[model samples]
Target chain A: AQSVTQLDSHVSVSEGTPVLLRCNYSSSYSPSLFWYVQHPNKGLQLLLKYTSAATLVKGINGFEAEFKKSETSFHLTKPSAHMSDAAEYFCVVILSGSARQLTFGSGTQLTVLP
Target chain B: GAGVSQSPRYKVAKRGQDVALRCDPISGHVSLFWYQQALGQGPEFLTYFQNEAQLDKSGLPSDRFFAERPEGSVSTLKIQRTQQEDSAVYLCASSNRDRGDHQPQHFGDGTRLSIL
Candidate 1:
C-alpha cells in the first residue's frame, strides 16, 4: 500500500515570505507524486507533479517541488508568498502497481498574513 | 466540456432518502474517478472507471453506495438511505488516459451533500 503524510497541519506566513510545506511518502515501488491546492469552496487544482522524469518540478503560480529519493520527501516551495496563495495543500502519491487510486496526505492549511 | 463537471453543486437530502450525484468528464477522457471528502479531511478515493467499464470500487464505504458509468462519458454516484454520516463533498475527476500512465487528473468543483 502507498500513503502520504504531510508534516504540518497548518502553516502561517507573512506576505512576501518564503513558503514551504513538507510531505513524506511510503510506497513499495516508484511513486508518482503530486501537489494540489484547494481554495475555499472550490475544487482542487493541480500545482505540480513528479513523474520519473525530473527531480525538480515547476508548477503553476510560481510553485515548485523537488523529489528527494533519499529523504523519501517531496516538499512544495515558493520563493515568495502571495496573499492569494492562502489555501489547503495536499500531497498525493500513486504507487506503480496499485489500482491507481491516489493516496492523499492529511493536508496543510496555509494562511497568509498581511 | 471545458473540464470535469459535477451537477447540483449542492444537495440536501432527508434521512432515509436516496440521492444521486452526476459527473461529466472532459470530452475524450478515458478514466473517471469519484472521491469523498469530509470536513477537515483529505479526499478519499471511492471508485474508478475506465471508459464504460467499472474497474475498481474498493473505496466505497458500503453496499448502499453505488456508482455507474455505463456510457463512460458521464458517471453517477447514488446513495441509498442517506444518513448524517453521508454528508460530505463528493468530487469527480477525469484523466486523459490510463491512470497507471501517470497523467494528471482534472477535478470538478464537487457536490456538497447534506443529509438532514
Candidate 2:
C-alpha cells in the first residue's frame, strides 16, 4: 500500500515569486510519483511524474518537482508564479506492480496574489 | 482526438435514488481508474480496470458501489441506495499501458453527486 501527505492545505504566493508546495510519501518499494492540477469544476491535469528515471522532473506550465528518496519527499516548485497558477494541486503515488492504481494526497490550494 | 470525458458533470439525486456516472477515456487508452473525492479532500482510489478486467477494487466503499468498463473503452460507475454520505465528486482517469516509461494519466472533469 502507498500513501501520500501534503504538508500544507493552502499556499499563498505573489505573482512572479517563487512557489513551493510540499509533499511526502510512504511506499515499500520504488514508488512512482506524480503531480496534478485541477481548476474549479474542471478535470485534473497531469503536471509531471517521477519514475526512477530522473531525480528532478519538470512539468508543464513551468512547474517542476524533485524526488528525494531519503527524505521520502516530492516537493513541487516553480521559479516564477503566475496568476493562472492559482488552483488545487495534488501529489500522488503508485507502488510497484500495483496495476497503476494511485494514492492521492489531500491537495494544496495555491493562491496567487497579484 | 479527444481526452478523457465524464458525463453529467453535476447530478442531484434523492437520498434513496440511484445514479450512474459515465467515463470515456482517450483514444486507445487501455487502463482506466475511478476515484472518490470528498469535500476539501484528495481523491481516493475506488477501482481500476485494464481492458475490461477489474483487477483492483480494494478502495470501493461498499457493495452498493459498482463500476464496469465494458468493451474496454467507456466505463460507468453505478451507485445504489445513495445516501447523504455518498455526496461527492467522482473522478475518472485513463492511461496507456506503456512499459518502462512514465505513462501520464489523463483525467475527466468528474461528476459531482449531490444527494439530498
Candidate 3:
C-alpha cells in the first residue's frame, strides 16, 4: 500500500514572504504526485502535478513543487505569499502500478498574514 | 472548462435511509472518480470509472456503496442504510486520461452529506 505524510499540520507566513509546505510519500513503485488547495467551504483545486515529466513543476496561482525522488519528498513553494493563499493543502501520491487510487496526506493548513 | 459538477450541494438523511449522490464530469472526460472526505481530513478514494465501465471499486467502504456511470458520462453513487459515520463531503473528479492519471484530479464542489 502507498501512503503520504504531510510534515506540518499548519504553516503561517507573512504576505510577500516565501512559503513552504512539506510532504513525503512511500510507495513500492514509482509514484505520481500532486498538490491541491482547498479554500474554506470550497472544492479542491489542483495546484500542480509531477508525473516524471519534470522535477520542477509549476502550477497556477504562482505555486510550484519539486519532486525529489531521493528524499521521497514533494514540497510546495512560492517565491512570495499572498493573503489569499491561506487555505488547506493536500499532498497526494498515485502508485504507478495499482488501481490508480490516490493516497493523500493528512493535510496542511496555510495561513498567510498581512 | 466547466470542471466537474455534483448535485444536491447539501443532503440530510436519517440513519438507515438510503441516499444517492450524483456527478457530472467534464465533457469527453472518460475517467471519473469518487472520494470521501471527512471534516479536516484528506479525501479518500471511493471508486473509479472509465467510460461506461466500472474499473475499480476497491475503495468503496462496503458493498452498500455502489457507483455507476451509465452512459459513460453522468454517474451516481448510492449508499444503502446511511449511518452517522457516513456523514462527510463526497467529491467527484474527472481526468482526460483513460486508465486514469497521476495528474491532479479535477474536483466538484462536493456534496456535503449530514446524517442526523
Using lDDT, give the best candidate's number. Answer: 1
lDDT of candidate 1 over B18-102, digit per residue (tens)? 9999999999998998999999999999999999888899899999999999987999999999999999999999998866577
The collision pairs in model 3 are none
lDDT of 2 by residue, B10-36 (tens): 999999899999999998888898999
DockQ of 3: 0.71
DockQ of each candidate relative to the true complex: 0.75, 0.69, 0.71
Kindly report which residue stretches of model 2 are placed more than 4 angstroms away from their true locations once superposed: B98-101
lDDT of 3: 0.90
**TM-score for each candidate, following the candidate numbering:** 0.98, 0.95, 0.95
lDDT of 2 by residue, A1-114 (tens): 688999999999999999999999998877889999999988889999998989999999999999999999999999999999999999988755556677789999999999
List CA RMSD, all candidates. 1.0, 1.6, 1.4
What DockQ does candidate 2 have relative to the true complex? 0.69
**Candidate closer to the true structure by lDDT (higher is better), 1 or 2:** 1
User: Across residues A1-114, which tens digit of lDDT does each residue of candidate 3 receive?
Assistant: 778999999999999999999999887766888999999878889899888889999999999999888999999999999999999999988855435767789999999988
Best by DockQ: 1
Q: Arrange candidates by DockQ, highest first: which order?
A: 1, 3, 2
